[model samples]
Structures are given as structure tokens and as C-alpha cells.
Target: AQILQLLRDLVSERDTALILITHDLGVVAGMCERVNVMYAGMFMETGSADALFARPRHPYTLGLLQSVPRLDAGRRQELQPIPGAPRNMLSPPTECPFAPRCRFEVEESRQAVPPLEELESGHHVRCFNPVPAEEWQRTRVGAA
Candidate 1:
């Protein structure tokens, strides 16, 4: 991808910062030491790629990961995309904007919008009812 090449060039040039905004997680995984996953004009999660992708704490983040397809050790592969389009960001919005598409959304989620919280050291997510690790694992199992 062009972005990847650019990032490589930037690193080669010893740039201090090269801010890139993109939807490609593969690019993040490849070139970024850290990443911030944003949605509807807000960051849902921000942390090192190793920590965030290795263990996503937010439902929105989990959903984003689930949307991407990965190769299995014993199988051939095709990329899987996230189900549903991103939420429309009108000039103004209310409540948990991603609720409509988030399977984990609950009654409490509808009551208020949550700001980012520090779920773990250096890992932040913007959901009041963050998914526990086991539940996230179960979701992947069910999807499998």
C-alpha cells in the first residue's frame, strides 16, 4: 500500500512524527508502533498495536478486529470485512453513537455516552461497559 511505503520512507528519513489517518489495520500492524482506533469522530481505543490487537478491551475495538479476516494455520484464506457500515456522523449526535451496530450495546449504553477510560496500563477504551476478555474470546469462538 502507498501508506506503508510512505511510512517506510518517513522512518527512513528519521522523521519525529508522521501522523496518518487510515482505515487499514494491516497498515497499522505493519508500520505503527502504536495506533488509535477512531469511530464517529472519537477514539474508541489507543495503545500499542501489540497490546491493543493482541487483546482488544473495547467492544467497538473487538468488533473492528472481528471484521478483519486472518489466515488459519491449517486453512487457506480470504479477508473478512467488518459487518455493517460505519455510523453516520451528522453534525450533531447523541447517546452511544455506535450502539446501533454494536452487538454488546445494552440499556445502560443507551443512557449515556462514555468517554475513554483506562482499562489497563497504557490502554484506553471509550465504552462504559467494556467487554471482559473471556467474553471477547467467546465471541470469536461463536463466530468460528
Candidate 2:
């Protein structure tokens, strides 16, 4: 933790770039201005940290966030774990890698990978069936 803080301090003081590759969302939230979520070596989503956290367009990204325990959530809040095992990275499929576990996956998801599409000024997601922003909040709370 001290090393991480020292790195952050050095980067800020010297105005240098820092590329941190981590799966820890807590670290990302604390240190990053931008975030890119990758699945099967392909970028599934990229955006500002605030934008991605506030509204995740890709099912994989949303599933990751929902699966984490949050202190802000009510005591009875349940974690929404992503179902199914991860894809085989040795020989990755040509189609969407997350399709097997994604609830919003469509026929196209299994047939071909979706191109990255911009949803807002700087937010982009690669998904054939992205969760609509209106549905994100509801779905996160198990309302959908």
C-alpha cells in the first residue's frame, strides 16, 4: 500500500504517466482517471472511471461491479455473481467472449464479436446487447 501511494505521489509530482494493470476495482477507483475492461484479450469497455462506475454499458463490466460487496448498500443487499466459468484463453473464440455468462447476450453474440461503439462523449463499449441506461439501475438492484 505504501509503495502504491509512493508511485501515485511520484507520478503526480513529476507529471508522469502511470499504467497500472490490476483487477482490483478499489485500486482502479483510487488511482485511475480512465479505465478499460478487457475480456479474452479484447477490450469490452473503456471510459472515464466515474462514467464507467456510474453507468457500465457492457454486461461483463456491470456484472463485475454488482458482484462486489459495497458498504453503501443496505445490509440486506445481495451480491450478483456472474454465472458460469470464464472462457478458455488458450484458443479464444471469435465471437463475444462474455456471451456464455451474459444474460443480455443475443444470437449475434455467439456468431460474431461486436465492434466498440461510443455511447457518450468518451465512453465506449463492445456489446451486441448492452444494458440500456434506464435498465442499469433497476438491474443492479435485482429489479429486472
Candidate 3:
């Protein structure tokens, strides 16, 4: 493990950028400085991996985080799953894309797409009525 860490450190000492595509958020948390979160060919958020994980602004990013089990979390704590299935690429959407199954979607969301806006600094969300962080917490507790 020490040898492997040394090799990783040596690689990071270079100017080369390594793009790792994986569902392993733990790996990203440990080794990555930046993160690009994407869904349905659209970017949900992009920024420092640590900052994003610490206080996720996008509902999608929150969902992704919720789905990952944490060693620090209690054993009785059940990880939340990402809601809804992926849209069929064969039959693309015409609205906010995620409106169909999004809990925070409004009528307008189903009729029009919303641009990704910078909520704060590097955090951005492509939602007109994103679920509030408080509401998300309630929903998780209720579901559990």
C-alpha cells in the first residue's frame, strides 16, 4: 500500500490530468481535487470534490451522496437510493429532463428546460424548483 501511494503521489506531481470515471465517491473523496457530476448528458455540478461532498448544492448531487454508505454513519442508517430510472435515450425528453420524477418539479419544469445556474461559487443546479436541503432531510426520515 505504501508503494502504491508513492506511485500515486509521483503521478500527481506531474502536470498530466487523469480523468477517472467511476461510481466510487470514496475514491474521489480521497484522491480527487475536482469532480464533475453528470446525468443524462447534462452537468449537474462541478467543483472541488471535498467541498461538493461536504455541502452539496444540487439535489442530484445530494441524491448521489445519500446513496453511498458511510463508515461514520450509524449501522442502522439506511442509504437513500437515487430516485427514478434513467431516461431512455431512444426517446429523449422535452422539458427540464428530470421533471418527470423529480420531487421538487413544478408544472413549468415539465414544459420547459431550465439552464444550469451558479447557485454559489462552483456549485450549479439545472432546476427551477430544486428540493430544499431541509425538505430532503424530512423526506429521508419519512422514507426510513
Candidate 4:
């Protein structure tokens, strides 16, 4: 908390940007205005923090958000783990890196890598089949 406060103070005092890199989602949610979700050395998603958190279009991003424990949950909800192991970086696949673990992956996902494309004005995602807004809303309601 103290370290975060000091960093925030520094950002405010100097009017400078801080590029924080970490696996801690809580800290990212609290501190970042924009976020880039990476997997297998490639950017899977990039967007405003609020948009990414509220409606993660990429399967990996959705999985990551689902894996986090919701503090406001009324009861215990089991974290939905991504179903497979991480890709081997030494000899990565030519196809979509997340296909093996992604529930929404299609035949096209296994054929070639998906390019990062803008879904909204500022939100971009690398996916052949992005999650729908309705599904995201349902998940959010269930989590709450």
C-alpha cells in the first residue's frame, strides 16, 4: 500500500507516466488507465482499463478476469481456470497461441494466428472469435 501510494504521489507530483509491469491484476486494476494483456510474448489485448475489465473480448482476457476472486461476491464462486498449459516459447505454434485453452476457439483459430484488430474505438484484441457483450454482461452479473 505504501509503495503504491508513493508511486501515485510521484506520478501526481511530476505529472509523469509510470509503466508498471506485473502479473498482479488487483494492482493493475487499481493503478492503470490503460492495459495490455500479453500471452506467449505477443499482445493479446490492449485498451482502456475500464473497457477491458468490464468487457474482455479475447478468450484469454476473459479467462484471466474469471480466474480472479471477486471481493463483492455474496457467496463462494469457484475460479474458472484456463483449461490447458501455457504454450512452449522455445518452439511456439504458428496458429493462435491460446487456441488450446480457449473455449471459444474455432477451426480458424487452429489454422493461423489472429491479428490484433480494433473492436471498438480504442479497444483491440487478437482473436478469431471474441466473446460477445451479452456473455460478458451475464458473467459480470453472475460474479456479482
Task: Give the alpha-carbon lDDT of every model.
Answer: 0.74, 0.88, 0.72, 0.89
Ranking the candidates on TM-score from highest down gives 4, 2, 1, 3
Question: For every model in order, what is the number of clashing pairs?
Answer: 0, 0, 0, 0
lDDT of 2: 0.88
lDDT of 3: 0.72
Error of 1 at 85 (Å): 4.3
In candidate 1, stretches whose alpha carbon ends up further than 4 angstroms from where it belongs are 1-6, 73-85, 138-144
Quick one: best TM-score, which candidate? 4
lDDT of each residue in 19-135, candidate 4, tens digit only: 999988889989999999999999999999999889999988888888787777746667778898998889877999999998999999999999999999999999999998888
- The runs of at least 3 residues in candidate 4 whose Cα sits more than 4 Å from the true structure, single-residue gaps closed, are 141-143
lDDT of each residue in 59-138, candidate 2, tens digit only: 99998888878777789978879999998888858889999999998999999989999989999999989888886776
Worst 10 residues of 1 by lDDT: 71-80
Best-matching candidate per lDDT: 4
Q: Write the per-residue lDDT of candidate 3 for residues 40-133, one digit (tens) a residue.
A: 7887677788667766656677778778776666889887787788788676568876666566678888887778887778767787876576
TM-score of each candidate structure, all chains considered together: 0.79, 0.89, 0.77, 0.93
Model 1 Cα displacement at 44 (Å)?
A: 0.8
What lDDT is reached at residue 93 by model 1? 54
